[model samples]
Target chain A: MRLVQGNEAVVLGALAGGCNFYAGYPITPATEIMEQMARVLPARGGVFIQMEDELAALGAVIGAAWGGMRAMTATSGPGFSLMQEHIGYAAMTQTPCVIVDSQRVGPSTGQPTMPAQGDVMQARWGSHGDRPAIVVTASSVKDAYQMTQLSFEWADTYRLPVIVLLDAVLSHMRENVELPPAPPPFSRTLSPDVDVEKPFGNHPFVPFAETTRTIVTGLAHDETGATRGTVGHASEKIIRDAFNRLNHDYAAITQYREYRLEDAAWAVVSYGITARAARAAVDILRGEGMRVGLLELISLWPFPEPTVQSLARQVQGILMPELNLGQLILPLRAAVEGICPVAGLGRADGELFTPEEIANAMTSHSTHAERRVSHHA
Target chain B: MPKMGEDLHQYLRQQMMPTVWCPGCGHGNIARAIATALEHLGTDLGQVAILGGIGCSGRTPFYFNTNAMHTTHGRVLAFATGLKLANPRLTVITAMGDGDALAIGAGHFIHAARRNIDLTVILYNNSIYGMTGGQQAPTTPFNFRSTTSPFGNIEPTFDTVDLALAAGATYVARTTTFDFAEMPEYILGAIRHPGFAVVEILSQCPTYFGRLNKLGDPPDMLEYERNHTIVADEESVISRDELLGNLPVGVFRQEIRPEYTHQYADLCQARGGAYRA
Candidate 1:
């Protein structure tokens, strides 16, 4: 156990997760991740590269992954936007790599120094085309440490780019984080029956390598890694299979925590730094005997629909407090499907929501719900 | 039964026959030159990785039997950089079209040269975006007409060989597809060079650059290259303008520099860290 910043925790977590190659361009809130990697990765016999831009950073990470190395890149909003094209490529090629997006306020480089959950939607759908995205958000230094390690495992297991979305506040904030004992370095399992001449034999998780002679391309390819562009059902089958691989393992991929949800009527749904305040708000509301609980989302994509649906049946209303203007609430509403009313308490002025604010929102939301029910009756 | 180079079947993926290049496209010649160069060098096919950017030239990697990756448009070199750095033993060769190499991917081109990474860049300079239906490319000759430049092009063209040399490519050479016999030797030289090597092949795009510019058939373009190009010698100093116009063909620069991967490994070892083999 040691005190560490969120960005520092990411570095420690990545090392523990067996990341051997890191390529990145220095951007604020994420530069420390690159700097730390540069200082430590080489000593650990790993490769650390400061690429010319974020495009090259992700591009290199994809190539390193194919070259039989666990690789990653870190960048903030503008840099993250630049990486979207290759992120699609990584997704298409089924490349196992981690992309750490320490998000700041942006449509374009809006506050770089302040915290915002602006990239939640971007992390899910920033890349073009229909593709499966595995995005996880971290709320504290501990979650940052553990989630970064889990991000690699998810990426390797699924053979796709896994995004660790960290907001500016959590990224810069420091706290005492207990680092777990490092696990054995994880490598993608190659099939024993894989033909050297034609690798990628029937296994979806197999990574490309020099020995494999596998041709990794952005064009839709079959299990053998050959380009099959809309020719038959092959392209469609491959894309569907890529999605199915994640969908089939939804139980393992979806991660979240319920704080005081049992016997609660109102819930605050939040993620990243906003979740920190939500947790506190849950405590404050519970102290007042308001029966308010919190649903802290750890996995942002695959949306934790089942859990949200179940929670919807238990709660009268849900208040989603986020740093951005109600991105996660939209999906939460769909998941709840009007069984329970969902309200968004969003702020994008580079300020985090306080416990008092969240507690007030929860009170107001439940009051409105009660009034609406009485009026209908 | 295969065609004339049936013996070279070992280097090619026989199943991926009937390539996407148009008839008389110089990309085929460039691809053949690559195959010949690897054969000449007796390079272990398994130890080679052919990377290609998106374009007509980007499809080159699919024909090869080695570890290949047809990457996104204008990003093959970036991918190759990572692959080479991760496993320095693999001989990395990148193929990119004129626009792929110089237009969108120009930043990577210059930076890769500056880093002096050991990769052979086979730039197929066709002067037009052949794959995307005859758009003007970075290497499109001044006043050359294309789909985008239907009127005469007002933009000045890039002398890629000069650009490569200026950007610190340790080995820089230019050859036309017409010089088929000599093209392989230049490619072989690039492959053998220990630092960043660029072999720009002046490939003719008969379907696009040729027809739009009224340069006749593929043979006519080849004739134009033969007539206009002058081989630079030690005795004469060729001006940039003349070199650009006449397409000065030959090895323009060669230097020894510390290769990036080797230096990185040495740095790690010097720091008492185990260098990744």
Candidate 2:
């Protein structure tokens, strides 16, 4: 067990998760992840490459993973934006890997050093099409480590890319996070049975066929991984089958942690650094005789919707505390079916949400919702 | 160098005799140089993989008797990088032409060199696009007429050696089919170079580039190369204008840098695998 910054935690978590190859181009907030990997990966018997740009960095990682190695890359908004195309390729091919995006302000190269949650939507939709991911967010250094470790597990288990969504605040800020005893849940790899799954196999095993466990690219591919989109075999079922297999077994990989929600009238759902501030506010509100609970989202994509829905049923309203203009609020609202009042509290001014700010939002919103619910009752 | 004999011909024939490349094309010369280099190294043929991108140069993989992949245009380096990292023991080589490497694949080429990946890139620079007809290429000399540039090209040529060197390629060299005797030496040296190595071969596209530019026949193109090119000096630095109408063919730069795969493996080992992470 040890204390570490969120940046160091990502590197350590990647190492523990069996990511032996890291290729990246240094960018703000994400530079430390590359720096640490460059310094330690070589000494530890892994390879760290500082590529010329984000495209090659992602390409190299994709190639390394193809060669049967667990690989990863780190970047900020600009770099992550460049990596979307390759990320789409990874998702379509079911290549098990991890990408850490320590987000910052950006439409095109916004503030480099400042923290922003602007990439929440981009992370979900940055790639060209509807490619799903197993995304995890971290509120603290320890959460960064734990969530990243979980991200690798989900990535390997589902055979797709997993994103560890961090922000500038968590990426650069120093913290004392106790390290795990031994990196839990060793990363998975292709089984020897995968040998039967060839790119041009005339007959492929049906189980792995639908999963695309072997073929990892965007080209229209058959079970053997050969590209064939002609009329006879131009079945959309192939795409649906591949994605369905991925979507079919997502629940086993989803994870989250709930805090003080047993008999609460209001719920605060937060992730990454904002969750820390929300928790502080929750404590202050509890002292003020308000039943406020904290629901820290460990996994963002393949979102823990079932839990959020059940919790929303118990609460009169839910407040999504975030660092940007509230990207995850819509998902939370849609999942709960408008049963509870959902409010998005965010800031894009590159400042952490102070506890007082969250307390005011939570306290004020809960009070307003209580009066409305009582009048309707 | 070992005498080019019956065994080399047998290796070539095994990849299917009537090769896809046009008759008298310089890609054959480039393929010969690569085979000679590999043969000189006495490497286990199975441990070497030649990855190729689409173009006249891409077909070199079909005639090379090794683990070869005919990948999409301008993507050879990306796939080759993967193959190298997978085993690191496998000698990975990539072959591509001007448009393949310079135009659409420019991003990949520059980035591959910058990483100093332990892969050898054999760029066959034939000035014009032969497979797609004589369109202008990145290496097409300024004021040279082509199918696309009927009134002579206006854009400056991208010096292959200069681009590689600037992009941090550990080994950069320029050779030509006109200097066939030296081609094997450059190829072998590049293969043995410890880091990212790029060998730019000034190849002859007698079919398209010749007809469009009125260079006449295959032998005529070779004669032009022999007449125009100068052997570059190691210590000298010259501008593009100085080399205008004259290709400088020689070893350009050779340096050493840590390979991407090595550092990647080191990270793996640190993470408790065979290599450090």
Candidate 3:
């Protein structure tokens, strides 16, 4: 239990989740994470390196992870863009690690120190191909701490890269947060020894000639870590198995918080910094006797899909507010299948949504709300 | 020479053979020098890891029986830095060609040397892009003929040893493939040196550099390297005009510097638990 800034919470969460090595090159709004980690990690018998650039930072984190250390790196929008290729490599290699993106506005080094959640879609599909990842967002300082802790756990649990998506608002905002005294839950698995000499045996999932140990390289492999070209059953199995871990066992990785949903006919599902505003707005609506619920998503990817779908079926509509041009709303609409009309409230003006602004939208006597509730019922 | 009395070819065949370099290339000689150096040092094969970048020289990891990685182009140093910091037990070595080390990875090369990272960089300089056609490279020597520089190169070449010394490499050495015996000693010394050792091997690329410049066959290129290169000395003086013809070769510098990882560990020790306190 402590009063801390959102950036401080993220740093504490990283330490609590057993991140022992941090390789980062400083970028604005994200510099606090690096500064805090530099101070905190060393005290906990960890390592911190300020790399020459974003590429080396990412490269070092990946190497450190392979060297059997829980590692991490932090960046903002521009630096995050620079890290996409290595992020893809981490996904393909199934390297367990975490990355924190304190997003700022950008196409090319846009507002360096200002807040914007413009990277919502980029976080999901930044890297090449269909590599699924676990993305969590922090709305407040407390969420920053808890969600970052969750990020590392999810990364290590599934042997995949986890992204802690923080916009400048939440990343720089200060608030009181009650952190759990003890460390959070996590599990790090060891590679099953398959005898390096025999390399690939008669394994069903992995193919022949692939190395026995985890190769940890970006090259395509047949599960045994041997480089295999894109062809045949090996390719199919690799893709299928990787996605199975993402889609099927994905439910176990989801984290979210629902507020005042009983008998609600409309919901505002949001993530990152905007969720704080959404929660405040939902409370005002609830006080005014409006049956509005807020689903504050903690896990941004493996996106509280089942819970969102269930709520969309029962609710008349969903209002998703974000800092970007409605990146999360598109996915919500896709999952809801028009069972509910999804309305988007987005502003990329480097300003956060005010509680008054969000409440006005929710409690408006819009005729569409009346028609939607009646039609759904 | 007597201490290492075994035949180089036989020793190579027994310990590391079936070379991974492309046929008709000079990388085999570079590989031979590296292997010979390790043999000279009595370095255990199990404890060494050859971290390689993407290039012709990057394939050096495949021929060696040591633990190694064929990392992405221009990123071997980053990976090697992590490996050395994590274990501090493995002898991490990076092998990269001219373009791989100097062009795409120039930033990393400079920083690695400046920080005095504990690793060895075996920079193979053949003065032309060999793997992806004979393109103009940072080390493609001024006015050298190549596919990209068909009319002749306008950019001046990088003297890798000089660049490394300027960038703070604790040990810096330059040797041509023609000086096989001395080349091995340079490699050995670079590997055993305290921090950020760089041994730039002036290699021959008969197919690319040789064919383009009409340096004749591989033997002629080797003979040219032997005759034209000078052993650098304290009193040695050459005019800028004379420098165009002669490339100095030999151990140019060696000094002990505290490595980045060790210094970082010491920082951790000094900060104590009061870091958070």
Candidate 4:
């Protein structure tokens, strides 16, 4: 175990997980990831390229992936925004890659160095088309390492872009992280001879076990890679099957951690750095003889909805404290479906939520009962 | 150029054609020229990767039998950079239009030239956006009419050869469909040149640029190119032709440099890393 910053841990994990190619442009809170990658990649038989911008960064990552390298890029909010088009292209062409968005407060660079969970929705809907995204949030330095490696595994497995969301604070904070023993269970090492994957085949984009005439494009093309232009049969199948592939296997992709929730009357749902406070709050509430527990979300998209639904049936209410003005709560409420009251505690002041702050909210909600306000509509 | 006749079918994807280029379009001529160039090189066709941006030129990838990727507009060079570095053995080529290379993707273009990566870039300079129904392009002649520039374009044209040379391209050439017979010599030189190589083919968009500027029919445009252009044997494209309002057509720059991918492999080796690329 070594004490490493969140960004440093990401590089350690990505390299350990066999990311052979990295392309990036510097942005605040995420520059360390790129800087470290450049320093270490070349020395370790990996390639690191400093691209012109975030658009070219992700573009190069996709190109490298097709060139049979496990590729990735690091960015914050503004850079993440620039990568949306390529994200859609990766989806359309079914390229396997990882994009780590160390999010900061932003409409356009609102608070460059401050942490904000404002990108929660954009991570899912940033691209133009209807495509499913696998987003995993990191609550600590170690989680950052695990989630970054896990993003690569799931990207290769699902044949789509997997985004790992880390906030400014979590990205910089250091911790004694014990690297996962033996790389995330499913991490893949591509062979040297693999040039391209058969994009439309049953086993898609997995380091070309067989050369299948790689003709990848962002356009809606048939199996032979000819442009269909209209959303005809090929486009129709692509769009229609986009969600089903991930949703049906939701159990496998969705990963989370539950803390002290058995026989609890209330549950606080939070993720990333906010979960640290929520965990302390749950401990504080339980010490005061209140049955409150914490459900720390690790994966943001392909959300653990069934688990949230089961918690709703078990608890009287759910209180969610977030770093933004309530983004993930939309899907949480959809999962809860009015089974219980769901309230939100949002902080966008570029500060972490204190344990007392979240504990008091849960205490007040448990007593007032009439103060139940959930965006059920 | 060895018989671009029925034998050239080995280099093409027969089913995807009839190309999306218009009737009497010069993009097809350039595509055939590239095929003959690849055919002449006689390398394993599977080892080549043809990439294109979003335009009439972008569709060229679908017609090649090699490993192909149709990338985003103006960003194919950036993609090719990563691709070539990833697998240095793969001979990479990118085809882009004026708007794709100069207007939107200008940054990537100069940087690719600056790095001098081992990739052959073909610019089908049609002077208008043919796929998007003829908008004013960066290569569009000064005050030449286009659909977007209905009142006649006031913007100055980007001299394709000068731009390539200034941007540090080691091997740069400008040819037109009118000079089709000589096109393969420059293309073959580009493919073998061991660094960033650019061949800017002044292709005809008879359907768009021809119509907007009243440049007569496709044959008339090709004939016009033959009449107006001078064979460039001088140090600079503008040395003698600038006075005649004529563009130069020939291989203008050919120099040697350490290709990006080769240097990357050397770096990996020097660092005692396991990278064999």
Q: Which is the leading candidate under DockQ? A: 1
Looking at candidate 2 chain B, the ten consecutive residues that score lowest on lDDT are: B6-15
Predicted candidate 3 versus true structure: per-residue lDDT over A268-364, tens digit per residue: 8888778888988988888887788899888878666688999988787788888888788778888988576777888877888888888787655
- Residues A1-377 of candidate 4 have per-residue lDDT tens digits of 88899999889788766788999999999999999988887777788899899989999999888888889999999999999989998888888899999988877878999999989999999999788889999898988888888788788878899999999998899998777543321234555554343355334564322254667888887544567555358765765576778888899888888999998989999999999999999999999999989999999898888899999999988999999998999999988977987889998878889999999999887765545443322
Distance (Å) between predicted and true CA of B141, model 1?
1.1
Of all native A–B interface contacts, model 1 reproduces a fraction of 0.69
Model 2 lDDT per residue over A327-377, tens place: 899789889876789888988878889888998998888878889978989
Q: In terms of docking quality, how is candidate 1 classified?
A: medium
User: Once superposed on the true structure, which residue ranges of model 3 sit more than 4 Å away at CA?
Assistant: A180-216, A228-236, A363-366, A369-377, B1-20, B233-244, B273-277
Which candidate tops lDDT?
Answer: 1
CAPRI verdict (incorrect, acceptable, medium, high) for model 3: acceptable
Ordered list by TM-score, greatest first: 1, 4, 3, 2
- The predicted structure with the larger TM-score, 1 or 4, is 1
Q: After superposition, how far is residue B41 of candidate 4 from its true place, in Å?
A: 0.6
Off by over 4 Å in 1: A181-191, A195-204, A207-211, A228-232, B1-6, B233-244
* Candidate 3 residue A14 C-alpha distance from true site, Å: 1.5
lDDT of 1 by residue, B130-209 (tens): 99899999888788899999998999998888899899999999889888777888888899999999999999999999
The predictions' CA RMSDs to the true structure, in order, are 2.5, 5.9, 4.4, 3.1
The list of candidate 2 runs beyond 4 A from truth reads A180-193, A196-218, A228-242, A287-290, A363-377, B1-46, B51-86, B99-117, B126-136, B144-152, B165-189, B192-195, B202-244, B250-277
Model 1: colliding residue pairs:
none
Model 4, span B1-277: residue lDDT tens: 4455457888898867788889989999998988888888888876888999889999899898888889999999888888887778888889999899999999989988988888899999999999999999998888889998998899998887888899899999988988877777778889999999999988888999998899999999999888878776456446543647878788888989887877888887888766665
For model 1, the chain A TM-score is 0.95
Worst 10 residues of 4 chain B by lDDT: B234-243
